[model samples]
Target chain A: MTTETTPARVTVGTGDPVLRVRDLQVSYGTPNGDVPAVDHVSFSLQPGQRLGLIGESGSGKTTMATALMRLTRPPGRIVGGEVLLGETDMLKLDEKGLREVRLRDIALVPQGAMNSLNPVMRIGNQMADAIEAHEGRAARKGMEERISAQLARVGLPPTVARRYPHELSGGMKQRAVMAISTVLNPKVIIADEPTSALDVVVQRQVMQTLGRLQEGIGSAVVLIGHDMGLIAQFADLIGVMYAGRLVEIGPVDEMLTDPRHPYTRLLIDSLPKLTAKGKLVGIPGLPPALLNLPQGCAFNPRCPYAFDRCHQDVPAVQQLAPDRRAACHLYPANPALPALPASVQMDAATPLELTGPAMEGQEEVAG
Target chain B: MSATPLLELRNVTKVFQSGVRKTPANMTVALRDASLVLPDGTATATAIAGESGSGKTTMARLLLGFIKPSEGQILYKGVDITKMDKAQRLAYRREVQPIFQDPFEVYNPFYKVDHVLTTPLRNFGLYAGEEQKRIEEALEMVGLRPKETLGRYPHQLSGGQRQRIMVARALLLRPRIIMADEPVSMVDASLRATILDELRKLVSEFGISLLYITHDLTTAYQVCDDIVVLYQGTVTEVGSVEKVIRDPQHPYTRLLVSSIPLPDRTQRWGEDDSAITEEQARRSTSGCRFAPRCARAMEECWTQIPPLFRVDPDRAASCFLRKDAPVLPSEQVGQVLKVMRPGDAGNAPAA
Candidate 1:
């Protein structure tokens, strides 16, 4: 079931990269000072590729995704960043140019499906409005058929288009939202915690629906969520974020099996296993406050491998391997510091077996 | 296990009526003939596992005396709670306390967080000279420092810290039973293990029986000793956590176990809508509540409700498939329920 609407202006060729974000920095303006929510974040998405951005609350993963679409509101400004959608610099575009780029080039499947749709409007009209806004009034002809085909692609019945948002279940509403977002066939789709509020069975169904749509449109997807297990299942590449910075980015298999960053390791270890055998230990202390971030590495206070240099100098993004990057003092890329012993490096690769009273007093070090 | 139960719910049922003019069609059955027993003289953790509309919260509220059951009795120490005297009720209130789901909503934002800990001590008249020591001890037990959490407001502390304070407040009363309703659902994944470990320690060290209610199957496996799988307020299966997870007898239990997304990368869930459709048929279904959704449902399952069939020496499931003999009438079902009591002698035929 394909929509009859013609494709909008195809700026980039099929083989080229869809989106690129270079050294993006976003800050929230507060009464005290500017809080750097996303500092020096850089990543790119190829056509039909899935990149999962994971982090705990207050980690600025949502802010980073919002900045990519140039949707960061007032008080939260894109202080420094270049969001490149194909050859176009998204940051430099005017409001009208950005509007044209939205839905035609990149679309957003918002966090809460309930709040995304207009409650007063019917589902079909809301979808038609999205199409009309992008494709103009003449494109609204035979809109019902296009809406139904898009809805059917996501496994929703055509009758759902006539119902109001409140008339549908949470899962149904989410599917409708997905259909509307992808009806325009955007090159890139950003789904922020798309299935976070759903039940387990429904969550899997929604994820499958999103996967099917992304495959159908051949759009690059940026899936942001906190569930590491869910992300590992769906995403091809995973990026771990902590306190607004990209701590580690690598292939999904490499990041899950042999994580280099201490924070990523802790996040994976914290997931409860199906079979209850050993005790799961959470990382002690809370995520650092963006307003009063600690000196040097932000994760140094909670990191178990902290040493002398970790307290003094901020770690830059260093290439750990061919396709992996980690920002940590332990993997110092420069030749200035002597390389750590092979035994110490091997210990970093293995999962830490935390026990006894060692976990206590770790929170006290975080000023 | 002791002969007397710390708490018991005998054939309890709750029906919530909606709309201005309440009719039979407007009525929603939250819980249906549900029975549970928490054994005395032991620190046991029993988890009531289910989805959103599974009536876990209703069961917790029924036990707490916040709402009375439409039918049947809730017993405390083998005595009906509704018939208790003023003095007995006060004692019962102290014995059964609740740890709510959201820590932030449980406390007021205007007051200091320590007020949650101090109010109970003051109300129970335990705020004496050693009040500070008791508060500090309770906080330490939950792995929170008194100095760090004493003067802060609800907004000042993290979600994990706020939840720990709630646990600390429960400890101050020295309660025998703690009803934690999805306590760690809102907490972060990293911090969930810490809170769960604290709840388990309370059972082991403090001899406090915990009624842990959650929709998360993984956490249920981690902390619960016994598990009760609730589907639309009906007890579909009940047994030791290991038995229920490893060898589930009921079809609903099998669906739930399979639906849990494990950390293992190899296993993937197949597309299935039977479980979801069964949940949607909850309000209108008659006979077996789970029949509409059960993959192995029979024709008789749509007309007659099934009784709890003993699947093992310790496990019981409400399913027609488990019944070897003829279906029993409602009167004979009472006899079956009596034998199914936690510490009762073996009076029924075992699987």
Candidate 2:
């Protein structure tokens, strides 16, 4: 594993570059067999940059995040992909190595992450518990100092560490979890919608704290959320996942200004603006289920631009520019199509049959 | 736009008495002397925006005619919903139906999905034979297929689907006023627009006035034209949504609007110093309740209970500052913008 320590680029390699996943395919082994929850996913991390994992539910964003910390539950195994950290691949690491990585190098702010903190236990005790898991030689006094430092770093008064989780507000609890997540100053931090439940003021403050903290430790951050606005603000790189596949990957500004995919355009256009006072022009259909994904492009069925060629062939990641990729046949070098009306979204119809044409005149892409 | 108001809350005051004695001893003033008039056709969608302890939900219950107001009357199409007796109340209820915040909460898990809508139509005597068109129309209105979903249970549908059915239930009655409370907050984002668009049709095309209650300010502004900002059971601000949200004069109103997280990264939070504090909320105020948090609090503001004073023809704010407002700060945004940093993007541009 080799990574360039560029301030802007997330090329992993330097001393267990926080987190790394390559061709990571995760699937649920149901009675029928394995259904890909995360199909051959790959990504890397860098210090201080927030990598936003954006997608609708069932797009495998959650599963992908869980796989990073080796926290995927039973029935869902990491079938493939090498998650490397420096010289060692996390998947190949023994249980003890995994334990060390989980605590020191990679800490997961788990999904439904706000409640991960014990409500009945004091915040100090919770942090201490995490510290005790790896606190072999540190004195009790040192641990206390670490706990207080963590609490203050997240903008909470030092005494908040002494309060029970229940005693704090929803925002406070979220902040406390953030406090615990960053205490050890791990190389990588994976936070799942850390500010989803918080109000705007607190939401900004939380992200502000994350940004400041990121700058302080230069820890590579993996932030997960549905709202693209938050992603655009914090994340340097944005990976748009759809139906268990990366539909579009690029720089935030690049994606926002010139989205190559219709789905990406629809997501941004659907955002109801205060200035534009009206019901949002939303994408016609709901996200496709990972269990029975459609042939060809998952978005082809609802896509207005889908012509004779859209339904048959699966479009691979086409690199339109440096660091920018789109899976739509209508990308750079491909013939252009008219801008589709995203608002023509009518009643929720049953899943439409995927019967469009091939991207390169090939067989059905739905298989 | 209509000559008469489709829905009206005339000095509506509702008190909830708790405890074994069921006394008014510790009655929660759910709504206090609230009054609003939504002229038919003119009022597209009206929003009741407030924080957790704010009386936004209580006002919704009143508008739905779920419970009688202790004082005052609720007028819908020249009729009082709260004052109506048994039979009259039932008939009147058909015209003013409620769509609860949690869609599944309104339906019985044992029954089919269509049962929720069909049951209401049947009760209203619009469920049989030729009336079948009404069922299909209701389903079409909410974007559900009657054939595909008629036999489905609540668990079978998504949160967005369940909520749409709830809206269809109200549509089945052909209600003039539809009271929807936080309908999309519990649902997924992709499906929210579908439901929101349907609500817009209720007012625009169908000509039904919508009393939409929500905490999400974005959707509130999107679907609603008028807004009622509630604070501790009082109407802190009320008027057309544009004037109220775009230029919030009330401290509580400003705080609530500012607290909502926007999807745009360029936006920053509006931190009005006047946003009432928790300590200020503990005890009721003699003057303006928000005076404690009001950045423009004056010596006179602390003593006199500020009456709802008109700022414009359609907008009003219950604050001493707006009542013949004196020399105010040139930079009025300082109160809110003080806490907001350059990079903290919560405020949308001037739009």
Candidate 3:
């Protein structure tokens, strides 16, 4: 392989991207065997930047995250392609080597953390176990003090280390989970809907903590969530998944403000706006099944801008604006691109109108 | 014809005393002197947003009368539901149905999707051949084609399909109001919009009032017309969805709106919540539930609780900053005040 295009041992956060996946495919095993879950998905993450992984249920976004964690098990396997973490290929790692990389090099805060916690374990002890498993020979000295500091970093008092999972509130437990996930200070963190089950207030707290922690440690966060709003704020760059494929990926502002893909545009416009009130319009159909994805673009059947080419060929993630890419047959490049259906870009209290008092004067620095 | 509300909670206060915790076991107050006026059977759902401890679920249970309030009353069409006997409560429940958050839990593992949808039919005495046709319509209403859905076990269907079935069951009863507590939170993302769209269709087409309780604000902002921001056992803000969201007057509401992941991060709509420290969370709390977290908190805010003040023709918020409380004259509402016990009816709860 040529040095320019081939893999090379370059320092992370400086040279090549931290992680790159090219046409990575995954699927489940049925009686018929091998149903595609992730269809030739491709995206790359830089060391200090975040890429939001989003999709509806059965979209395979979670499956992709699980694959990165190497947690994908029976009835599920990587069907194809490269999962490169630095110059070392991740998909190529054996089970044992993958384990080392999981906690020490990267970590995941699972969505099931809400219930996955062992009720009997003290919050601090559980964290200690994680630290010990990864810290290996060095875990003996200052582990307890380190654990206390980590808990405090996540907004939990050091005393929380003494309490069992059940004693803590749902939000607290999630925060504790975050603490353990980041305890190793891995280069990457994959959080799967970490705040989906939380209350609005606590959701904010957890997100702020996660955001701050990510910034402090300078780890690239793989925030997997369906809530467009959370993804909008947390993701520096976004990858909108539809039916196991990365339909769109770009800077957050570009994707949210001026969407190119029909599915991406549909997803943004479908979000309930305060001003939309009586005018809110939800997307018409469900996401296509992974086992039997629709022909051409997976989102074609549900897309308002689907043309003949969209229905015939799988749309590739093509660059639209600089640093912005979307998987659609229609765009500025394709002057003959079919026009999207007439839809309201803004609800009654459009985001444009939401300024000053509505934002509590946070608007000045908000944008 | 009078100014009576379609569904009203008049100073509703629910106190659940756990059987445990001796030495005057603390009672959990899900609601405290809460009240709201909902237009009868308005299709536009009213969103109740709050943090977990803010008691949004307790309010749902109160609205459904699943649990009785320790004090005050809940009125449906001007009739006191708090005082309703067991049989009366059952009839009231029929009119005010609930669609649970986890659609899978609503179904029996032993039965198929059809079985769960039909259970409400048999319980409500609507299990007839005509009910069969109604089932199809309800399924279609939730965007589920009956043939693809019926007979499938809860395990067989997708999360979105199961939730749709749950919505179908609620629709089957033709209930006047649907109490959905975080209904779509569990469903996968791609299908969330479809369910939300279906809920919108239910109101615009079916004219069913929806009390949508959730912690997510973007979805609420997308779907609801009016909203109430709940604090610790209290209503902090209540008014038009646009006003409360676009320009929240209450610090709590502003915090809540800002906490939400907005579609646009550049304009992430609220204050940085660093000010709401744990010490502030503990010591700053007083007359105003959010005084501890309010950046503009004043000393008087600690002395007396503010009442809900109508900020405009269609909105009301409970904050001294609004300064427009019109406490109903004791002479006017005193005669109609009610206090009732759930145990008085002695009707056995559903098995």
Scoring each candidate complex against the real one, what DockQ results? 0.26, 0.24, 0.24
When only chain A is evaluated, what TM-score does every model earn? 0.87, 0.85, 0.86
lDDT of 3 by residue, B262-313 (tens): 6765565343666556766677444887788777777778878877765654
Tens-place lDDT per residue, model 2, B186-274, is 66556676678778878767778777887677778888766777777887877667778888888767766665545554564443342
Candidate 2 residue spans exceeding 4 A from truth: A1-17, A111-114, A335-338, A341-367, B1-4, B14-30, B40-43, B68-71, B77-80, B256-260, B265-305, B325-351
lDDT (10s digit) by residue, model 2, range A1-367: 1111233444322443456678898888777566787876777665565688888766778788888888888888998998876566889888998988885777777544445988778899888888777766554667777777888777677888789877888767877888787777887888877777665545766676776676667788888877776677667778888777778877776777777787777777777667667545556655665555677887876676776667888877787776777888886656433466565543333331222111111101000
Best model per DockQ: 1
Model 3: which docking level applies?
A: acceptable
Candidate 1 vs candidate 3: the lDDT winner is 1
Interface RMSD, candidate 3? 14.9
Deviation in Å, model 3, residue A101 alpha carbon: 2.5
Ranking by DockQ: 1, 2, 3
Indicate whether candidate 1 or candidate 3 has the larger TM-score: 1
- Cα displacement (angstroms), candidate 2, residue B224, comes to 1.3
When candidate 1 is compared with the true two-chain complex, its DockQ is 0.26
* CAPRI band for model 1: acceptable
**Best first by TM-score, ranked:** 1, 2, 3
Question: Candidate 1: TM of chain A?
Answer: 0.87
